[model samples]
Target: MNVAHFEGAGAPPRKRPWTAPGALVVRALGNAAAAAPVEGAMLRFGRGRPGDPGKPVDVTVGVDDTKVSRQHGLLVHRSGWWHLSNTGRLPIEVGNHVLQPNGDAVPLRAGVTSALISTADRRHLVELCVNGSEGASPAPAFGLHTAPGHVWRLDERERLVLAVLGQEYLRNNPRAQPLARHQAAAQLAELRPGEDWDVRKMDRVVEAVRLRLSGQGVFGLVQSDLPQPIGNLLSHNLLTELAVTTSSLTSADLMRLEGAD
Candidate 1:
């Protein structure tokens, strides 16, 4: 008598190892609700399925969308920041930066950042949130004081331009986003009918502010610091820094714009 044995079913499937001290949380925004804490060095995202060739993505972004490639993009943890890299045919919108296929990875700031994948008919969004380590010390507030020289310096005209461009942020709006140049220009024209305020003038004023801040050791204010198709990245970064670190733009300034409207 003899016993029959299975040909190749001896061992269990190998489980993916979980890295200690999770660093990031990735959540897909849509009908498909998939959320996971990234405990490893990288988190892959795409429309891939299990048992596919090569390494499959960790998260399914556009499950039902045929346009989304199987291995669309990935988030890599490096140097205390999460960098997003797009490897799909279409571009991925991260904040104001559009990550083209095979482009350089863009480092995401702390807090929640929305990444969008757009198709002809619909849009897919993924939310990435980098968590600070438990018991970690608060970040130092360098040059974030109310002292005269410590705060960012802006002339009257420059302040007005930034006030208009960053009104939403100054209002503490949770959904605040940087305003377009045209919108800011139109608002400025209303605020100061005598002074000529067009897109070109607004561009110059903002550029001057950025140059000044960049000289002060502020990064991401210059074009070279950001990826191509910058969109509103400069404005977003500038406004966020101004809103949190300096009194260059305030609620009174926003009220001035509101009073005009």
Candidate 2:
């Protein structure tokens, strides 16, 4: 008796076969919650269909989402760091950095990093966690009076300006966003009417902080590191870093501004 056979045909595949014990873990957030380990040097992500035999991606991000390309992007382990590279038409937001399609790879710092993949209708979040590994450094410390050691010090004026700019986050606003330059300036003026505070001064002060932080290895502070129409990208990134990594800004800061004449 002769048995028909196919070259690649085999037993049913194991669930999340790509996953294994490794230093890097990539898990999709939300209902799908598909996860895989970066056992190899690289892992690809893209749109995946429910029951397609073909290997769409190592990790599935969106199903039947036209916006997500078949081979959207990848996570590559190189030089002891997992860097995210976007290969699709749309951009991928990883923490404060937005990785544009075909753009340069951005290193993912140690610990949990949130990456957002947006489709036509909704947004899909993928969490990339890099466990302790060689050459992997902890996220930078930019907090005042909170960090255990090695804090990114800010002058009095810089601290005040940042506090005003990040008041929304300090207030625990769910829809928090960095305040506009003019708005922040206005608040600072109200907070200290004697001192000169305007758009120009606000820009200078914020720029100084951004430059200092960027020089200290913080990502997403420089214009070239972000896309155009930056809007609040600089302030947003700075404030986010401050909000998460430090107690540099707090509700009391906001109360001070509000209570001011």
Q: Which candidate has the highest lDDT of all?
A: 1
Could you give candidate 1's per-residue lDDT for residues 104-205 as a string of tens digits? 888865555778999999888876655444421133367786656346767888888988898888988744678877888988898798898899999998
Root mean square deviation (Cα) for candidate 2? 10.2
lDDT of 2 by residue, 51-156 (tens): 3566445556775677887778777765545678998888997875678899888766556687888877788777665554332223335674583733567777
- lDDT on C-alpha atoms for all candidate structures: 0.68, 0.66
User: Poorest 10 consecutive residues of model 1 by lDDT?
Assistant: 1-10
Error of 2 at 52 (Å): 1.9
Query: Roughly what TM-score does model 2 have, to 2 decimal places?
Result: 0.53
Q: Which residue pairs of candidate 2 clash? A: none
Clash count, predicted structure 2: 0
TM-score of 1: 0.50
Number of backbone-clashing residue pairs for each candidate, in the order shown: 0, 0
